[model samples]
Target: MSKKEKSTSVNKKTLGRILKYIKRYSFLVVLSLICAAISVVLTLYAPIITGHMVDKIVGKGAVDFGALKTLAIRFVIVVAVTAVCQWIMNILNNKVTYHVVNDVRTSAYKKLEQLPLSYVDSHTHGDIVSRVIADVDQFSDGLLMGFTQLFTGVMTIVGTLCFMLSINAVITVAVVVITPVSLFVAAFIAKKTYHMFRKQAEIKGEMTSLVNEMVENQKVVTAFSMEENVNGSFNEVNKRLNKAGLDATFFSSITNPCTRFVNSLVYTGVGIIGAVMAIKGRISVGQLTSFLSYANQYTKPFNEISGVVTELQNALASAARVFELIDEEPEIAEPADAYVIEKADGQVDLSHVDFSYNKDVELIKNLNLKVEPGKRVAIVGPTGCGKSTVINLLMRFYDVDAGAISVDDHDIRQVTRESLRDNYGMVLQETWLKTGTIKENIAYGRPDATDEEIIEAAKQSHAHSFIKRLPEGYDTMISEDGGGLSQGQKQLLCITRVMLDLPPMLILDEATSSIDTRTEIRIQRAFAKMMKGRTSFVVAHRLSTIKESDIILVMKDGHIIEQGNHESLLAQKGFYYTLYNSQFAH
Candidate 1:
């Protein structure tokens, strides 16, 4: 789909979700409506009293002090009561909007967590962040402000029409003749503006993504001297955003002014008719003055309604984007009848599995593998040979298209995803560490792990010595992604985290690839110790790391070309022999 079409679809979904959110807080909505009604009634009384005052002052030659004082007191009391009601309405509206926004933000965040890895792989991080933070925030105007003005505007229009019609039907009919035309014009402007606003939001998300990419990869850009290229891309997105913003603003600007012009015409016509009636003595001066005031009051509400329509359109655009995210089906989810697989003994088997990320291209074809309990199997493969795909299938990150994977004699598909995942500890190639103390990072696998257990795990992974050498020992705070540590240290930290979990099964994907040769040797030794009595799958590019494995599989082009013990594979002098010789020849 085109970007515009995708954006429109997303926006419609977002709006639907927003309505659901509003429904969840129906009690608050009802309360806000009650407060708005009370405030509107008090507001209407103010205009009526003002009109009454004008008539009394002009119609009576001398003021009746007692009657005038009573009218003034009643007006003040009504104003005070209305002011209180408005204050309550404001408080209630704020509370409702805050709760709604809070729920939206929370829901958006949760949805992000539940989303499959495939969804994240396909979208930019900044774009998703913008939806959660910026787009969700826009709902305040969409739901709260729009709802408030709509309620008040409707009440004002109805009340003014009733009072005006009662006093003088002819004048009321004349003033309201253009009402339908004004509404049609407002609706037309709103529809046009909605598209513009949706475009503006999309451009903003793209710009946000661009900025995020530039900031996160600033080092790479500087190293490659591609600052100019980065800046050009950023400028392009910024220009689109600027153009869309200007268009939306220009369209929104016309709405209020046009409505006011139409209202002005109505007021002028009403005055002319009222003046003629007064001159012919068909209506008293007081009545004519009162009728004029009501006509003028009527225009204010229509103008407010026009402005609100534009805001509502913008809000709908935002809501639609949010809903699209919430509506997405997760690529990976627990089966309806998923059972818990507790006490896994760690034996893993992949039988006749076929899989692909895209339908037409199979990444892994008819793959079969088995790892006995407490066995160390190392998979050595060239780049893009489906080495990681094997690990992904073992962890059930993506289900097989055909056949089944089993853990401890149980088909993994029948187990709850969480229970299956809980049985394994993984140390990925990329060492991702949150900002926290060294102890916290290590204990992340088991949050409730005691300090002693954390220290022991760190020691097992050879991270304890380096951690202790730091200024604060276990208490030393690590920057995000372990910024304060060396690459080797970060890898060790990830290893320590996994060790702390002490799961029956383990998968280490290039766990020591980034470390120095010397550190790799130490990490390998630590890993060997951890794998003594556990099932392990190790994907390594370094042949030296897997030479002593119980079984070594040499893979190329997504298929295992050779599999045997180290000596047996070397004896065959096939794909495995070629790879080992080629690496040593370097």
Candidate 2:
């Protein structure tokens, strides 16, 4: 998990999961292997025929044109067939690689939907994207080369060994004995670099995460004039990535040469011994020539395998990360008898709720509150007072550690999450708008909304006034998160989204904080009309907005220190009085 240390050893369990995907296209895999097998056979046959040609020419002590012509034709046919098979195998390998990677990406995306909010909170957005996109891509490329070489190399080694044994067993034994040396060298280097590759992958994910965070928050970076600082931070991450990449490549690069060196030693041993055997008359000159060629062929596969080994190691590391994502625990299972609500009457209740993101650091504890149907409730406190945490609990973004939250007297945990969320509307200070036309953004929550309903909702949040003035009006394209719109305009569009939902309950967290006072008053009047007969929980800092609330819950350290209407709490001169005084009395 550290910068240098990594779990690079092939995780058999995770590898097993990765291999399970091969079953989805078993026929293609088998066909690829078959193509490799046939290609190896036809290709190896040429060397044998050449050896025969040598014997026939030497036996008569003259060239035989008739036999030579026939041999040449046979050679041409074999070459064509072998080439075609190799091409077919290459095509199939790519087919399998891409299809499998597609499934991997799809599976990761679907898993994202089922994963808990806490899971997303614990991971970086760029890291998630890296595994789902970049890592999977590497995995596919590596696997493509891996499978292509694996089947061919294995068949070539096996077929060449068999031929060598038949021609001259003594030289074949030399090759067989020396083959293990190459294997040992490859294994050792793979072990040494496995950690490097795994560490490199981890660093890549970190770099991706850092870059994504900086890019997404460019506004904040520029506003703070931290350009130099951001560049320095990026350089730091990039330097680490460079070192890891260099280390991994340096080790893997040596493997090919090491295997080739070992193969050269095997080739020398075969040549020397086969010549001696030929001089002893135990094997003919043709046989000796064939044996040497066979020995070279035998060692060639192992030499080729050095590259394959490194590729597989990298693929395994990528597979481990992808498997890690796929294996993550999804959301907790819904109860067998969980509440399934058909409708809610806007009654919201919470009692004796204890919770904390971390066990040792309690945030919200022993909390209790009740809001009657159609009432407007407001929560206010200084920052870090758990106002947003309260809203998170109500939305079941995080479950309470203890006690219950109910909607219409039904425990929220028992209800299906879809039904629970579908019944409430929310408009937060941080407006979220996607890249689309102006109308699409306002109707995001209710995709099936008609033009009349969308316009009505936009009018309610006072978004229509500005929207209509645009060059294309409702059809005007907005970039991601409403790029052209001001913060206040974006917020109104978000509030309009909620209005279109028309849910039984509403939660507004600093909904009008970004709007100018004049616009704020208009939106507040619109909100007052919307909350006429629906429960609403408003987390606000501006005191004037919530002055007529049916209940004002002043929170501190996650508890309601004071709860009453605007006037009664002010009459008591409790926390609300000081909170109100600090703003207006200034």
Candidate 3:
């Protein structure tokens, strides 16, 4: 990680969110603080009693066995009580920390659901996972340690100061004089390292993204014999992470030792000053001994705090990344009065529609088309000729920059998105099958589908035969994105999903591209039966597939240059004719 890699600084808003989570467990937090105070006070008793025993031995001629026995019992009781309170505080701290992390993690996941597809398209899956998992854990760990230290540290510092003041005010003042030097050292180092820690967290996310990409695409990498290339890319990212990690660790590591060195100076000064006061008869030897103990206890907390500050900076950076994700802008909001489409007749019209992923580069410009209910429309175009863009617009995955798309005279933007989308069944070239049983994957489009319906749909789409051969049949588990299944098999499963849905409108974008020619012919027959009395749009590479369509659109450079049935386009000897001729030119 370098300055070139974007880093998110911890702002006041992110800090306020952490505080809000803490306030949710306010009662428990208060209980924790109370316990810490009692523990710290009890801890001070041992040193105080030790000072008394010293006085009993030195100030008197003979040793007092009864007094020593009483001091020993008091010490034991103080240690036991302190241990119990600490145990309780640990329990309370863990409860508060994990609950806060759970809330943050859930919010991040929920935010992903609310976000548009564009956001997911724009981010790496592994980075998103790291934000929700690793980042939140780091934030939780820091908050837990910070809270635990803060309460007891403050109590210990204050208690030690009071005890020392009571013993000898002059020695106490000398100890206080050297305190700011140690604090300054910690503060100075912390300020310079905030950016370094932020970079480290960012690089960690990137490294995770690289690792996930390599793992997920390993088959592709191996097929291309690009394992060495993939390793090279990973090594680049890993090396950056190493450099960033080293820098972050170096800065944070120095903080503790440097603060401790400052603390040692303070300790040495207090020890020397207290001994001088004891010899001058201004303070007793026993008083000097207790003051030294109090001084050591006070300085130790300050040292621990310097380390906590560094840990917190790193955690804050991780938290800011999580908050940034949660704060992402969602898709355009639907109106409260938007129309709802319970069912669609599949009458779709795109009038003067314009859209572009990039404003300067026009992808879809002034596109106009209309189709009647229960009609078939086929779109034939070269790659990047706005074929997928049209599908995206129809699905409202990316809303048009201008004009409107309407289904049955109901403008899509004017209706609730869920109701509008529920009207259409879609199967794309890229199939997505989550980890689940085959039955569950088929039922994804229509969760309430009966077992009989699922099996029937699978058979209709030619997926049932292959599924029956698998172990456990319909109960066979599918890996992420249907890992074990071939491309053709995955396509069959997707087609089965669409078949089960039985929507009034269907969009098949290269739906049969992955299937073998024979299988494609078979599925096309199934599709023809399924397409009857349904408004269907087919985007196919095979000219044979669209020969009998109601309409064939030949598109180029984001515009439909020719529109007619297959025979008419070939008769004209135009762009579609040349495209059709080239496929079977041999």
Candidate 4:
């Protein structure tokens, strides 16, 4: 009904979800709770033993040394057992906390694989990474604190209450009456801090995204003299983060001291009430001393629990973020009887297709195309003309809004995505290589390729020379995205992957855009060899590269205005002619 009510509902839901994950390892959790209870019971017994030893001393040298010696031994044994049980509880807590964190982190990462491309396209990579790594790590800390402290704190409070009631009911009632003060303070602070902590987590993600973007493109930022501008943007984000973090911390920190203050009040009241009882001769000095010790033990948990509450709030905020990612709608499920293209015929047809990333903005409408087997079809279009969208559609990365796309006369949607993609070898302008040796990258598509085969493919793509020049040659370790290599070199490595195993169809979307003219010429020769007798779709901006294609489709504003071979299009002296001459114009 209200904002606070809604937040409380969300926190309850998030905490419920976390408990479900913890339930998967319920055995360890139960064991940990048992250890905490035992430890608390042992800890509570020590105060009674202390009070007994004190009462045993009637006067100087009139002491019952034997009884005192027995009490001392019992106290020592209680302390040692409490320590051992506490240690065991802590170990079990760590085990459960880290195991649950690992499971959640693994699930988040696996979710990325099933998520639709649109989801990733809409969100920054850094933010997604933050949810998986940084947010999960924060959740781990909170869960660990909750496990180690919350259970023991509750057990201690209950154990001390029972022990104190056994000694003196009047003083126990006084201590119990003041207990709600600490709980009320803890609850009030927790409610106040929940939203602030959530806001802080969001800002932290934004800060992480900005830093990742800057670090990844630091060279570009410096080359364009954007250091000052980037710094200004970063400072803006940093300032907001600082304010949110300080506000969240300031509120959560209040819980500890406020609860401690209430605890002191409870202890003082217990002492005063017990002293009155002792003077009235209703209880011995020993019993009063024991009641005072129980009062401290009972109130100590409130202080520890208040701190746990602070951490639990922070943890719930981060857990909500991680669950948000996990809850995203994944890609459209495949048909139960999805066809598998064992060997594709390479005949792709798009009929009456209509699609757009945003519904209001019409990018591709009533688009129709047909490519026969072994045809070299090139799509040449200006920027923002839906050149790449076609590639994405063909690969089924994005489904069509209207009409259908078919491979070999079978609807693309009818076939399994893995099988459809397996039939085509793709090389895009934007290259991607994981952290590994150059040899490993080249053989990514065909990991079982032998050394000789890898070298042959590398030589065909003209990457062999660079590979040999590296300090470790083919075995040289490269960072993620091929960090140690140039852009051209990275593209070459990608091309080499396709060369290593040429499929039935190929999609070369500006495959050679990064290579130098000299290297481009050599790579084109390799592509020409690779494209022989294979259905190929080439998307390019450099018009000269596609002139030799069997059919050139010139697109403008998502419409194919002209379609024919380069020679026929030029002879028409139409839009394609204007585009062709402009590229070769003096």
- How does each model score on lDDT? 0.83, 0.87, 0.88, 0.91
Better of 2 and 4 by TM-score: 4
lDDT of 4 by residue, 508-578 (tens): 99999999999999988998999999999999988989988999988878788889998999899998888
Q: Order of candidates by lDDT, top first?
A: 4, 3, 2, 1
Ten contiguous residues minimizing lDDT sum, candidate 3: 2-11
User: Model 1 shows how many backbone clashes?
Assistant: 9
* TM-score of each model, paired residue for residue: 0.95, 0.95, 0.95, 0.98
Location of the lowest summed lDDT over 10 successive residues in candidate 2? 2-11
RMSD of 3: 2.4
lDDT against true structure, model 4: 0.91
Off by over 4 Å in 1: 1-17, 59-61, 331-333
Ranking by TM-score: 4, 3, 2, 1
C-alpha positional error of residue 528 in candidate 4 after TM-score superposition, expressed in Å? 0.9
In model 3, what lDDT does residue 120 have? 92
lDDT of 1 at 514: 81
lDDT of 2 by residue, 446-523 (tens): 788999999998888899989999999999999986777899999999999988878888999999999999999899
TM-score of 4: 0.98
